[model samples]
Target: MSDAFFSEVTGRIPYAGLDSTDPLAFKVYQPDRLVLGKRMEDHLRVAVCLWHSFNWPGSDVFGVGTFDRPWLDARLDPLVAARAKLDAAFEFLAKLGVPYFCFHDRDVAPEGKTWADTQRTLETVIDQIAGRMEQTGVRLLWGTANLFSHPRYAAGAATNPDPEVVAVAAAQVRSMLDATKRLGGENYVLWGGREGYETLLNTDLAQEETQHARFLAMVAEHKHRIGFKGMLLIEPKPQEPTKHQYDYDVATVRGFLERHDLAGEFRLNLEANHATLAGHSFHHEVAAAIAAGLFGSIDANRGDYQNGWDTDQFPNSVDELALALYEIVRSGGFGSGGFNLDTKLRRQSLDRTDLFHAHIGAIDTLARSLLVAAALIEDGELERLRAERYVGWSGDLGRSILKGDAALELLSVRVLSGDIDPRPVSGRQEMLENVVNRAIWSVDRAELAAIGTPVGAAGRG
Candidate 1:
């Protein structure tokens, strides 16, 4: 594929270290740099999502499309426009030097009025995308179906009251799965966009839950039948367009998987913005998912703390991401999972160069965070302190309680007879905070010097 879309970007983005003042160059995201005995690229495995980068036209509830995209011009035919978009997407990915990309069936192809037409359009686009991937060595990280956009799924998809609508959704998912397998995608994601109700007064909660479970089972069985080797991930979001989403959080999805007998087949894809929406921190969600052994992937983006809605802003906080990466590293790192930048450009960022700037910043932020996390692990003080705090859990009493060998009655008898007076111990919260702060500050100081920022001069002013 020719670099027709981003002709201005010239060649591939290069790692120029931190001293280079060029805006287009990567300062910290050296793909080949080793971290924790693995190449940075291998550890990060960042993938750009098409739905946000290519398909979204910077339109929101109150405004019309504000960005200029030739592929999305009204003058172009639907299929021709879809092909142009795919071409542009590949060029963008290649220029950015991203190893992988993700897309929804609808993001790559325009959905036709008829079901047959929709499938044919999607297949045709998939073939084109496959060719581009083969040529550029860019792999598909995952593929999904846009079940929430159309009016047909306003009520819900799999959890819809109407069986016909649910059947249609199943057909769409089947086609998406087939495409994913054909493209050698590493994973397939199901994001329940409208799989919740606006009001319980008109909804059948029990029936909806049962229907959702059955729907997941059907998809899992189909995945097995097709002999696809990719992981199946369910992304959790507390609520947005609906009052309550079924896959509300990591714990909720964990229970749901166990209930549906799909625990072995499906895992949670944690999203930072979604975690915030669920009234939790990003690291908290990652830890929860990792603890349950369900951490499969990440949708890398941050939400505005002041905004209640999904802002989907490009993540810029090195401190926040460093903590999240710490948990990710402690969990043995991503096996079949990778970070997908599920973020969008702000409406004001209309220039083509803004896309490059946004991605470059995000990639560098994650890379720096990975370095900080690695340093924290190497120092061992943080982990040692944490383990010391949980020393009671490694003792005989803790072991007996965990092994189910000691019941509440026995513990009560021992407590009463032994006259065991437990004294409260300080958590040393401030001291631990200082340790983390010092580590982050050390990294920040080093990075600033590397980037030619006079650290002491700024403070002296």
Candidate 2:
């Protein structure tokens, strides 16, 4: 396959070829034929979480004390420069070839602005931004409900013990959902940053979870009433600002959704950094969601154990990286969802361009990984090996699966099974090496030249 094959998915030409002026909405690359067994550039809509850039001045204070003093100080110059700062932020993202962006409502709210005033002011700002987004074909992925902002929410938000505070949290999310629809956003994210408790003696887990579900149900009802056609992406973090949150992991959240019968309206926004914080592989996190049929969106950020908490570093590890791509490939590729980079820069000195570079590099790496995954899946080797590994299984369900039958048939067979090696015939390390190398070679000649000549080009000559 060659560039001709790439045209199949990305149209007859790359997205860049569609409208050169609005590069932000279509920054895609043609894959090297060597990478994805077929020549194709998987067109993806990438987004940067606005929190990373808009709140850079407060990087040093993350995981520290409350921002009541510095943040609420209406006299501060930077605080007063909210609109100008946001304009610059949007312009910056636009130049990076990113069309979609996510933000927290609190991040853009004017200092000392009452919650009601914030809502009114935000509508005006979003209307302006929406026009620009429409012109550029960019859209918001909806902002988060920063329930953590109010001291009143110190206990919790929707799950707060105080009924008034709980109502406030729910109302805030309702406004956000409405704002999201106004901006033509396709989805909303719930991070649950302040929905946990430190002591069992002081909190009620059952009430919290129930109220949280009620809150989501009402939001869904509101959307239905308004005829909104977007999804609610629930991001699961094992631990963070709160210890042991209700949506602690993918499995927990998946179960919650099923029990509440809200699985159809909500899905997981798996975050690599959040997964790492929970001591699990990011790939594993996505795999769980995929298996449960609830995988919705992604929070593209890398975490480091040494960094402490959710670092939101750009993804770089080859293993975790490949898994991320493979998970998407197995799911048959995303259609219209955006890759929201839920990350932040702790280093205050890092320039705006540096953030762009990090996003560019990470996205490019994942694109290449996607190529490798397509090859592996298309080769039929993975499925073939798995089938052979389960040959002659005693369990009826296992036998059925090995015999190319339905999985549900084995519900009757408990431990009646033969020993089947779960390991793949080929190691993942070797698989990734082959995939990455092939991807590198498949990049277009123009991109290759721009990145400097291939390492062994002299020999090719």
Candidate 3:
């Protein structure tokens, strides 16, 4: 399809239109055409999460504040700067060939007014950015509601102990859903990082879980009645501020949605860092969600167990990403969804755009990984060699051979002779090495230097 038509239909450009040498009005940027399958816009949109948008020291007040005053002031300048950043980011994304974005509520309304007034501001911002998004061929994956924003819910929001607090949380969700619909969002996501408890004392698990389910059901019903077309994405995080969270993993969320009859309309936006935090491979989580037919979205990032919760680092590990790429490549390449860089910047980085380069580098690495994996799989001998290397030595065959010709044959060197060649398998590994090694050799370093790279660059613009 034409890029414009594709953009209109999916609210994004198709994978093919990502690279245009026909020169637009923005900086000259072109992502390496590595992953030969499709463009980020056409294949599946890549989004930047707004969790790290503010670039402020005191912005976490939305999560830990007693009052919203200080947080509001920090938001103003960052957002004004962010709008410009958004333009640049879109230009960068367009050049990278990825399209579509998932916006957090705070990206637009970072404590400028009352909760109600902030909601209105969100609506206005969406309207304002809609044109620019169209120009850049980016579409909305959805909008997020900051459920962990208020201190009134030190316990939780929808799952709070207080009935009044739960009511307010639901009300905000309803409004946010409306805002999503108004902006032509494709889906809405909820990440209940604060829904679980650090202590069992005075905690009513049944009541809280039930209330949370009821809140989701109500939101679904309300949106259904209004004929809202967007789906809902429920992301799972193990724990952070609280010792345990309600939607701790995909299985937990799957069970909750099933019990609440939200399994169909609500799907999982599985974040890689969350999976790593939960002690599972990120690719395994993606595969699990896909197997359950609930793989709706992705929050792409990495984490380290040695650190605190929500580390939000880039997925730069090669082997981990190779496995992930293999899983998705074999599954037809992220069928109908997108990847959102759910990353953040620490107090360390002074430059904002450095975060952008880091994200770009991470994505480029993954793209290369995917390409190498697909090549290995299609090479015709790697899979058979791997199977022979593994399955022949273990399982029932190893135990069943007692003491006859069979046992003698098992010990026989002839049995291990040549079901698969080790040479080709070595070549596959070497091929992967070459693919990764050549990633940088293909880069035009001189061109990058000409761009006048900025400093203190942080945040995935």
Maximum-TM-score candidate:
1
Give residue 357's lDDT in candidate 1 (0 to 100): 93
Q: Give Cα distance to truth, residue 442, candidate 1, Å.
A: 1.9
lDDT (Cα, tens digit) per residue for candidate 1, span 103-137: 99999887888989998999899889989998899
RMSD to the native, candidate 2? 8.3
- Please give, for residues 1-461, the per-residue lDDT of candidate 3 as tens digits: 12321132222222222122322211222333334445433443567664463323323534442221222343457455446445544554554455566666666555545776666666666666676677776677778777785787788988888889888778777877877787678888888867999799979899988999998888888889778887788889899877998888888888888887889778888888889788888878887887787888777778876975677777676566666656666667664456677776544553444444555556655554554555555653545655766664465554455323355655565457864234433436775556544543333232233344333331225
- Relative to the true structure, how large is the alpha-carbon lDDT of every model? 0.90, 0.66, 0.64
User: Model 2 over residues 1-461: C-alpha lDDT tens digits?
Assistant: 11121122221223342124442223334433333343443334567776665654533553442221232344655434555555656555555555688887776764245767776766766666676676556577656667786788877787888889988888788877788888878788887877788789888778888988888898778889887788778889887788777788899998899999999988888888888877788888988988898887887778776786877777655455655766776677655465777766546434444554466566655565554555556666666665666564767755766777754435334324633334545446576456545543543443445447564563352
Candidate 3's TM-score reads: 0.70
Clashes of each: 0, 9, 12
If the candidates were sorted by their TM-score against the true structure, best first, what order would they fall in? 1, 2, 3
lDDT (Cα, 0-100) at 266 in candidate 2: 87
Q: What TM-score does prediction 2 earn?
A: 0.77
Best by lDDT: 1
Runs in model 2 deviating more than 4 A are 1-43, 62-80, 111-113, 391-461
Where does candidate 1 stray beyond 4 Å?
444-461
1 against 2, candidate with superior lDDT: 1
Task: Provide the lDDT at 149 for model 2.
Answer: 67
Error of 1 at 235 (Å): 0.4
